[model samples]
Target chain A: MEKTWNNKAWFMVLPVLVLVAFSAVIPLMTVVNYSVQDTFGNNEFFWAGTDWFLDVLESDRFWDALTRNLIFSAIILAIEIPLGIVIALNMPKKGIGVPICLVLMALPLLIPWNVVGTIWQVFGRVDIGLLGRTLATLGINYNYVQNPLDAWVTLIIMDVWHWTSLVVLLCYAGLVSIPDAYYQAAKIDGASRWSVFRYIQLPKMKRVLLIAFLLRFMDSFMIYTEPFVVTGGGPGNSTTFLSIDLVKMAIGQFDLGPAAALSIIYFLIILLLSWIFYTVMTTSDAQG
Target chain B: MDFSWMAWTLPTALFFLAIALMLVGMGVWEYVSPGGNPRVGVLRFETTRGDRLFVSLLGSAFIHLAWLGLVGANLWWALALSAIYAIGVFRYV
Candidate 1:
């Protein structure tokens, strides 16, 4: 349906504009200012052109963190999407179990990020945490605090636990919205379960799955809290993603210019990559 | 009555209480208004005011978590992000 010209509708959006101006525009301006100028002591800044940006781009540390971020997001999307789909497929469709399962799934998503981090932190402690104690009892020297591999494993597991529900919920929403007639038609055609899913369910769920994929990608790429809490971006910077590294620079080291440049670069990367992904996927989605 | 185990400050309690009251107020508003006339937003899906509210709350929590982890302990940015998220949800989600 085409919307009629209504200049009055702009009035409805004024509040949003105001909100964005203060919340997004102002902070972004601060970052932009920081990205350009070198800061000394006592509220003094010197013009520093593209020096910070070039420095950040040249830094091996920045590149390493970016690589780590890419790898982590790639792994997360690879695991969570299929796993969530499988779980959503197996979930009860029409019973008391639906609500129970949904609530159980949603519980993790509702927990505060730091709280989730803290929960995993304590839960994986070698001395007091249950998982660590059990692993030790089973003769596995699993120490997340000391082992980079263990720290990565813990971070991945922590993320999966915290976020897989989002994918499941979106997929489930798509699943439940499929009309009963579609199933009946498939049954009349003697379609197998896999065939039904492929022809009917999967196609129907395309939009939501795209949403799931994008949401997961964005969230994982920006993941900071759980890993920061679990490993403090260590086993010696091994678990440090770009966001974690950026925080350490901007906040921990108080390096404003380089941090701001890194942040702008980071944001641009996400924007460019997401734009490409959306266009490619949506074109395929539209055709399929 | 020794309530030391509560683990929350007075301000935090009041904040929560205010939230509860706001939710109650929203409930009453919903009942009075009845049909929400769900409209298509940026998602191209028709969503009610309640759906927007739910989305904003969930998005706000994530924003807060991200801010806590990546930014400083200060909550001003989170509040800003939450406000933006709320507006986005109402306008788009």
Candidate 2:
């Protein structure tokens, strides 16, 4: 398609640019300012160089949080992708079932973030919550607050409950769009079910799958509120992800300099990973 | 999150003023670039610029909601995810 290649196109993007400048650029500049400068009472400020950055880099707490973040993200992607595909495949493709399935899937997504966290937090309480009570009734010990393993388990379950619908919805969209002719041709060729899916459905779903993967990865890596609400990064900081740690530093303890430095590093990591995802997905899309 | 800044800071007021100017600027851009050929993308039909923008905005909303659901409330992750979504929209809608 021939585009006009007009310098006027810049004007079309102007609104987004302005919005980003306010929402992103300004906040980022503030963070950057805080990173290099130290403030005391009455807003007195002095240059601090990279001292804060160095401190954060050397801290074991930072390293531990980063590791926890990576592990959680890895676990989520591994489970959600395959599980979502399976659930999407099994969902009714037609009739009243389709809308029902869609509505059910979308319900979890409509809930607010903190509400989801609160729901799970109460839902997992060993003494009163359904999950906790059921486990106790069965003579099983499950205390997310006191047990590191249980805290990890509860957090993972809460995340899965909340996010698996996204993968299902995206996959369902891909699945529903697969033309009937593809399946008819597969049937005519007497292709095995696995072969049919492998050659047709899976290939057709690649774009959405790429989207699901990258979206999940970025979200999981930066996860905070749910775990913060659920475990409070508890059981001795075992579940403390980077975002939580950053908040604790910046807001909890009011360590602006180190927190700002950490925030920059955190932003850079997500940017790097997202860039890699975009490049790989787009190049593969082009080749395909 | 706080709108109090708008009342206190010149920079915040400038942001809103910039947004108003941008809306008018975009109308001019459309007028100058009379006809734009719709591009074929991941969607079944070809999409014009507005179509692409709409899809991305909707897609990015879900991405953010899902992030808050499964992950947390860190805006940086949302920004990164939005970046990927914008690339996808531009590349394939």
Candidate 3:
């Protein structure tokens, strides 16, 4: 096949360019502007240079929030990936059970983020909530409000319940797409179940697994709403991830300069990490 | 267009302009040479010229930020370091 160059094709992309310029570029420019400037109040501004960026990078508060974010993301990925694969492997391949399982897996994902947070917030109350009350009855001191460990556990469990379905759905899609021929050949060779999975299934699911991993990593890193609604970032600053910290700086304390600087640094960190993940995964995939 | 609301200043404007020029220069280079001729670099992955340029720019941003954090507000040294980094990325990365 041959291709023809058509300059008119750019016209089709004009709308999207315009939209992005307004939506993403404009706001980003404003953030950059705010990042380098300081204001006392009421439109009076002074050129502060890179002071805010320096301040953010030097601050213990910013580092603590970042560490919390990294730990939370790491824990989420550790729990969700294997659990999702297991669930996907057990899912029915054919018949009415397939749709039922799919719908069940998708239900949590369909719920709005804030609503999910609210549900978990109420669901973990010692006074009336199910899990909290049960723990109390069992002579366990389970209070997410007071105990940092309990808060972390509740957040992790809440996240697993909410997001593990996405990974399962992705892996299931990968599983179902495998031709029956591979399974048949494995059976003919007298391969055990583990070998069949290890050799055939895992390889096919690699691409989807990568997608699920990256999606979960990014989402968990940027997690704010659920933790915010549930614990309100504390008895202290225990659950304050980067986004929560940014919001507190920007809106709560109205520290625009530092907040803007933090925003740029945060965005850059995600971009750099994601790029590394994509490069490393694809490179290994090519070699393997 | 009423652009005053954004509170743009001279240094910031120059910074953005430099970025825009770099992008335009890259686009022109691509137009002149076509395929960027990707090569495996010291990092053990394949990268095209544009990819190298991106890597350089991103690395420079971090270098500048790190310098700002570790050192003082005098950014001339940071700028020099970033320039050297960009050169290194172009040459080897």
Ranking by DockQ: 3, 2, 1
Instruction: Score chain A of each prediction against the true chain A by TM-score and list the results.
Output: 0.97, 0.96, 0.96
Docking class of 3: medium
Minimal lDDT window, size 10, model 1 chain A: A40-49
Rate residue B42 of model 1 by lDDT: 79
Cα lDDT tens digits, model 1, A167-193, are 999999999999999999999999999
DockQ, per model, reads 0.02, 0.04, 0.72
> Please, what is the TM-score per model?
0.75, 0.75, 0.97
Runs in model 2 lying further than 4 Å from the true structure: A1-5, B1-93
lDDT of each: 0.84, 0.81, 0.92
**lDDT per residue as tens, model 2, B1-93:** 764322223442464465467557556766788554476666545566655654565566456544644565454687698878877887875
Task: Give stretches of model 3 more than 4 Å off.
Answer: none
Evaluate candidate 1 and give its CAPRI docking class based on DockQ: incorrect
lDDT of 1 at A153: 93
A1-288: candidate 2 lDDT, tens digit per residue: 886777777799999989998899778766766776666535555677556766776689988999999899999999999999999999999899999999999999899878999999999898889999999999999999999999999999888999999999999999999999999999999999899889999988999999999999999999988999898889899999999999999889988878988897788778767756765776677667
